[model samples]
Target: MTGGSTHEIRPLRFGVVAPITTDMPAWRDQLRGLADSGFSTVLMPDVPQWQPAPGPALAVAATITGLRVGTWVYASPVRPAWITAWEAHSLSVLTEGRFEMGIGTGRPGIADQLRELGLPLPPEGQRWSQVRDVVAALRELDGPDRHTPVAMAVRGPKAQALAAELADTVTFVMPQIETRAATVQRVESFDNRRGAELALHVPVVGDSVAAFMAGPDTDPAAVRAADSLAFLPSDPAAAAEEIQRRREEIGFSYFVFGADAAGALAPVVAELAGR
Candidate 1:
């Protein structure tokens, strides 16, 4: 059963995962466009080799627009937990509490990246400890006067438990093959365990799919056919209805979309964000 009946559904919030594009002026314009378009947050991915470091990039974005700035997620295994915490705390203080720290164990193939970087490729449990350590350090740094929101991406029982205990927001990640029924069950299970805000990461909005969301061989039609949370209809009215359906049926209130969908969904954002 849908979990909307069990808990208070949160107000709708929209975020865009926009990587830093060329020149500063362009980046500023892009961020301002997102803010003007009703997006609440602008997030950066933590892939060091592909983009400028997320910390500095996010700080710059915070200065350019009134929109909140954050990491779509920081990979905990790539660096020391204290260092990541320090960066997160600095961003929060600089942004005046407009920073949301999303942290998780590194994603699939992260081990190969670690090997290339000559870093330790720890066991799954050890990676989670690093995530916990980052949040703990962030708490110590934030102290009583300030609070920096933590969004943890979890896919397993132990990770979900840690996120339930420590995160202000939690996003569940699952295999691409997982159906809507399986996704709802996972969210319901998490709701049974904790009451934090729930976020859904949308990789395909309409016909556009972010490059990082899928491989060259991955078909957008296939993802859409699976009724995946990653897919959303392109039509503004239809997209709005579907988003509301998700909130009603799955209790997902925070919807994060790829940069590609920002323009396509602006009308939907205007209609439903914060409503």
Candidate 2:
């Protein structure tokens, strides 16, 4: 049976990961446009020297009614777990239940970033431990009354196990060149462990690939040929159908796209969000 049979089907939800790059008024307008276009959440990535901190950026996005805001993901090893949890809990309170905390053990090449910042680069096991620590601290700060949904961006078996235990949403961080069959295997492995909402991160919509997601050498044709879930057809109808197929075959209900594809994916979101 497909992974969908292993868990309850969640309503389709769409989020946009767009780092702040404009003036306050312009950024506000962009956020409003996303909300107007039927997007549910506006997310920011946590990369030093690339964009403003996601917590403050998300706090601003949460000002727009009906639009939720979150960190596309906070790298757990970048800061102490308690500090990350404190900021996350504060943002949760500021957003008034409209914030979702997405955290991970940093991305590929994170070791270089750590070295650049004069921080010690811990081993993989330690990084995963930090992720768990962040969640535990966040829970303690939240206590029993407040519940801030945690979304974990996981890749390896250890991460998958941790996510199954702690996350409200699990986002699989697949490679740019990973084949469809490989992806199904990854999804099914997690499904066997636990039942949380599944999220698919789409970095390419049609021919346009977000630079943040794909490197300069990434070829769109190659990704499409591999049948990667990271790529989606730009056409609204086709994209919607493909999304539905994914939900049925692999159990992904939450689809997050890069900011560049926001306009292109709007119609699909309009047609399928909440269904």
TM-score of each: 0.95, 0.96
lDDT of prediction 2: 0.86
Candidate 2 runs further than 4 Å off: 1-5, 191-194
Question: How do the residues 1-275 of candidate 2 rate in per-residue lDDT, one tens digit apiece?
Answer: 43434656779999988787767887788888888888898888888888788887888788765688888799988999999999999998998888999998887789999999999988889999998999999999999999899999999889988888899999999888799999988888674345788999888888998745556677888889999988899999999999999998888999999888988889999899999
Q: What digit string (tens of lDDT, one per residue) describes model 1 on residues 172-267? A: 887655678889889887743456888998887777877555545656788888888778888998999999999988889999988778888999
lDDT of 1 at 274: 87
Give Cα distance to truth, residue 14, candidate 2, Å: 0.3
Deviation in Å, model 1, residue 61 alpha carbon: 0.2
Q: lDDT of all the models against the reference? A: 0.86, 0.86
Error of 2 at 141 (Å): 0.4
- Worst ten in a row by lDDT for model 2: 1-10
